[model samples]
Target: MSRNQRWDFVRNKNLCYCCLEEHTVRSCRSKRDALLHSYQATEEAGNATTGSRRPPAVLFHGGESSKALFRYIKVQLYGRNCYINTFALVDEGAACTLIEKDLADELGLDGPEKELCLRWTGEISQTEPASKLVNLQISAANQGATRYDLKGVRTVAHLDLPIQSLGEKLIKSRSDLKSIPMPTYRNAKARLIIGLDNIKTRENAIVGVPLEGRELEGDDFVAVRCRLGWSAYGRQCSGEASRPRILHVCECNNGDRLHDLDEAMRNHFALESLGVTVANKPLRSKEDERAACIMEAKTTFDPEAKRWQTGLLWRYDKMILPNSYPMALGRLRCLEAKMAKDPALSQFLMESMKSYQEKGYTRQLVREEIVSNSNSWYLPIFTVTNPNKKKTRMVWDAAAEVNGLSLNHALLKGPDILVSLMGVLIRFR
Candidate 1:
């Protein structure tokens, strides 16, 4: 429609600006249908390329329905020209350059020289190893396909979509920029993300909108930002603000001196454990406390050997159970306690013993068999009803000793016993 006719429709007859329809813009069905089709096409194309998609000879351009725009550039790897699809973003806070494995394989990049440990990406707190680094020349955008040499680029398996930091410096330098379009992807694009390692330290806390607190859940602490870009709410560590007012300082001794003495003592213990011949000297002066500390314990995993080793002293004989509370029945006292607790349990026990006899878990002992064996270990078998199922379950208490030795101590306990048999409770703040 002409400008004069459009103005006449807006002044005389109320109509939508988008489609010049009689209804308001809020009720525009055509726009909604177009958006729906765009999203559906993206999903269908992604699903179709699951197994048998051909390699792209040129860069893919981001369409109108895309969340972020993309650019395709020619990358020179190993004296050959290769096309790489990439997302050019405004900001990619504190990230390094990364390349995907598939592109690296196609480009004939070598195996990884060393591991790359990445940190601080949503829910990914662990370090991930990267493949071998390679040097490449990538065609610069808006510079008429001018090639620039980029070195030490690392490759990873899932580095398909990379957000290249673009208007970050512009936003920082210019206060006028309210929001910038950050590059993202719904499907595979660029193999490499440039300028990731160029990240700088950000402010401790960003200025946010007013927010309300919610009921806390989950074990690990997480900082959650609201939809309004306001103050985050999640589990946070108790700081000085949460601490009590009362405080005390004792001038007992120098902490550095105490630490030195402790380290010297540990080194001595380690040397003794190794059976090294050394002179035992009493610490006479402050100079004696200044000795070097023992090296910290190290654990190493051998990928080839498929085993883990720790530089810790082996203590095969001694056991370190968390809690060591005493039991009610001990050393042949179990049978008498069982009889006193419940006599019906005795009848159930006898029935279970008969069943055990049939199953060969337990057998009837003849007089000759008893006489032939000088040392006998008599273990009590008991039964208890499960509350949930209301069914009787048998338990062999080998720890009920005949001659003061516990078979339970000698053998490894179960997944249940590990929890149930604990004598101490530890609570972390």
Candidate 2:
């Protein structure tokens, strides 16, 4: 073809390089469709004759890179088409796919329906539950899109996958030497990240090196380790003391390895958030020993047991925060007198006391005595019916605002409160 004619052909027509056809790449899915149709027909025939047909497993690979292989894909949101890059991270540990909120916003996804507090693996602090979930259509290049449900988090940032110094230099040189053609790589960032929840299908495969050279069996999942750390520029935050550490996650198959790793992580005993390495040296005095606070917790609610659980609390000073307004000053009304006046509330209080005593949360009173008090915190009690059951349980109104003041902080504010109150039924799982 003439130069001008070739240019016109390239610009005007979609060319398939694989088959040297006049269709865009991946446009011809006849082979795939035919295979799928044949499989479906066989499945149907088997179901009719043999009562059921076992479906084949769908597999995916993580490619040579630890990150799951990425592809240029088109996503449909609100009936509009948006082409973006996507990849899967085999968070075989987590149950749901999570997308970056900004990427979702660009794709015209609505705000999260509700907020949830959660934690990522190796995180010392539980993240503020700011992620929302939505469903969208995602497809491989030139293929029909499929519905994919994902949880969207505002905190999911661009992962700077580490590369060799030589690789980095080559990429920079290539960018400088020529005009990069792909729009996606101009400012490359993965827009979508699929997780194990959506990956439970037979259609997707996990590309990975199998342990023991055997195909993955039940609960066989992939894990990868990467270096993670950060530093600040100013003198206040500078120094090699802020060195990064290896963050590794193995979700499945390697039970012994996971157990040992978990034990090691717990024993590392370092103040991770501040980068302070914990030492075996003993503190010289009680005054020198600082209290450790629990900041994050993961819990599972059981409707059958009527409880919430799964966290441990170590020894720490159990004290309420100093009261700003003293009750001994006679600024607040007496709750003892109020409880006596209302029989229903009084009974609820008695039941709560009994429950607390039974669960080892509180000790039974030895004798009734008139004790003078400052800031006499009177936590009111109420009956809460379990939605899944007809049974009613006594619940203290700790969140209630009393005289425009709250004593929620005065109570054990973290996982300890839950751990203390719920007995064996709520022990850490």
Best by lDDT: 1
Every model's TM-score = 0.25, 0.25
- What 10-residue stretch in candidate 1 is worst by lDDT? 243-252
lDDT of each: 0.44, 0.42
**Candidate 2 per-residue lDDT over residues 1-429, each given as its tens digit:** 544565456556655434445777676654422211345667678788866556666644333322221222223333145645443233344544556666666676655555443344445323334555566545433245344333332334333322211123323333221232211222233444445555433444322112221112332221221110010011111112322323222222245557988888766644443665545764433322322133233457778757866543323345333343343223224545656787876777688788888875767445565343544455554566678886667665656554555566444333222323555655433
Pairing residues by index, what is the TM-score of model 1?
Answer: 0.25
Candidate 1 Cα errors over 4 Å, as ranges: 1-79, 88-92, 121-123, 126-130, 141-143, 160-190, 196-429
lDDT for predicted candidate 1 compared with the true structure = 0.44
